[model samples]
Target: MAANNGLRYKDKVTIVTGGSKGIGLGVVQVFVKNGAKVVFCARREAEGKEVEADLNKLGIGEALFIPCDVSKEEEIKNLIEKTVAKYGRIDCLVNNAGYHPPHMPIDDFSSDDFRELLNVNLVSYFIAAKYALPYLRKVEGNIINMSSLVGQIGQFGAVTYVATKGGISAMTRALSIDEAKYNVRVNSVSPGNVWTPMWNSGAQATPNPEKTIENGANSQLIGRYGTLEESGTACLFLAADATFCTGIDLNLSGGAELNYGIKTMRGEKELPF
Candidate 1:
């Protein structure tokens, strides 16, 4: 179903990481359009500011851009502090910032490389949650972690990335159990082949970019790649609508995990309306 664009979250305070582009941008846009007061951060100040300015012009919600590198613990702490100081409370936190390096075999990846990837993709989420929890507890807020379908199913040539995502899903469950007493929820969204800048970059790096993209799309039961809006809407659902949900890892995989073998649209026909 299509997401409702109405102002369902009017004035709710939210923080989203990596909100300058891709799935993060989509989450920010969805939250803002739903009448939220969002503080979004990215390493790129210019892009963050641009997103903030453009979103603010919509006149539906407020957007504040903060420059941050999530790999640093201090930066994550500061981000939470600044948001709480400005908004007085945080209703939701969306941990969406992540890095997916070029595909390579496990043997080719160094321990240091794996550690660095963990810092960016997994450790940052932990740090953000550590700092944001007190405020979230105060308001009974929720967290929506951005995970990946590969975290569940395995992916070849991406052991490091898969490890990080798997950690996120595990952490989401454990954190939710710990925070449930405070009425704060923790959950995750695992997406498959979402159409984002990172995906485009990965595709472009391949020898046959078009064929690579086509294969990626065909991997899902759906005939196309998932959209940013779809990813954003899933987060919104977890944050705003799934009141009793916690420790749940929602899959936005377009049925990619269903059945076995390669997915194809062969012999498909449209049904009568």
Candidate 2:
């Protein structure tokens, strides 16, 4: 069969949380384009519907958009049940549903804000995996958690977000160990500076949005922001091709996480990519 002739993930079922937009949407597109039947969820019903409409046009695979708030247990359960009911089996689970709240000073964070951050950013990933595990076990499928570079290397002024991301990376390793007996692989994708809606939002919040954007691009060694499609491709590789890989955290950043000595650093900065 041709690569596009339903070869890669042909008829395989996958679930992508937060698939309406950003990296999650990119993942959904990659899987669907490769012939995987996908079920994705978003908190915004309107945005979810829009994605559903676009994905449905892909004749090779089917995409279902279920409005879901992954932060809530009941909603998470519903998302999984609905997927299983429609597709009968789940071959992959991409825990891409997440949120990054504004940068909050450590001393200024309220109790509710702290809890909300963890609940959305970290807890949702665990809950979705918990509900998806039984089906994943049957197929010996894999799990891909969407983590961030900030998780591995702490970010200033975003203590809670950083903590949640770090937790995700650690969880990926630990879960890989636990699921080994069942032949299930667990891993994570830690993205660097992907220019997605999240990044744009952060830029919009800054005093000089354009300048902040430029600075962000220049921070990456690649001199440009990584694309959503790139991040999506990484997730697809982890789910479909990395059969012997587990407990590993793949960095999707363009060498942004690497540490270089001051002497080796760029003598002068160039235009951002």
Candidate 3:
């Protein structure tokens, strides 16, 4: 979809999970600037209120910060109920709350660790979508799922995170089909190496974090980490203008997801998957 000078989301109502920081914060800012009233939640009350106050002061679009722990079904249910209660209708749901624990191999994690990861990173998306679907159907709205390049092609030491992201991509496709009859579109945005606070913090866990981040930035074909703004734009495009698209995984990778040329040169003939 192409951008226009007009307010794309004028008067639209949106719900953004994890809107306290990173890509989620960017999405909230962009939507508010475009004239959509946003209801966003986070586990941290202080950060959420700070964001809410900042957005409200902008005097563009309205923003509400609801403190929530998305890992709980009741909380997600309450989030959706509160959203519809205030707005009276829901137009878009951006499922963006997820985290990757420090890079670790499969055997490093216990069953409980894996289960907790699954609950917060993956299951919450489904629960949020399930709760929002009925009202989304009423408005012919859409859902934007945040997947990752790590999910598509396994990230070396992030098996658990990769699995959850892959599940998101798969779920997005299935959901599109289920929601088609109701005219609600579903799609995923998969980002490669973004330089958000979450990414920076994760990188800091390594020895020589400066070197690690530098190596990551230089590894990108674009010679820089992807910005949260880029991801926000992709999401806004899917939500406001991708009218003909559904069940699609739109990649905003800075060539990080593409190593076909190097792989081909190395004579690798088959994909691992």
Residue 226 accuracy (lDDT) in model 1: 92
Best by lDDT: 1
- Candidate 3, superposed: residue stretches over 4 Å from native: 1-5, 260-273
Question: How do the predictions measure up, each by TM-score?
Answer: 0.93, 0.93, 0.93
Residues 38-76, candidate 2: write the lDDT tens digits: 999998999988887888886778889999998899999
Task: List model 3 lDDT by residue over 136-244, tens digit each.
Answer: 9999999999999878877766778899999999999999999999999999999888889998998878877888888778667788988877878889999998999
Which 10-residue window in model 3 sums to the lowest lDDT? Answer: 264-273
Query: Scored by CA lDDT, what does every candidate get?
Result: 0.92, 0.87, 0.89
Better of 1 and 2 by TM-score: 1
Ordering by lDDT: 1, 3, 2
**Tens-digit lDDT track of model 1 for 1-273:** 235456778789999999999999999999999999999999999999999999999999899999999999988888999998898999999999998998876788999999999999999999999999999999899999999999999786789999999999999999999999999999999999999999999889877888888988988899789999998899999998999899999999999998888434356452100
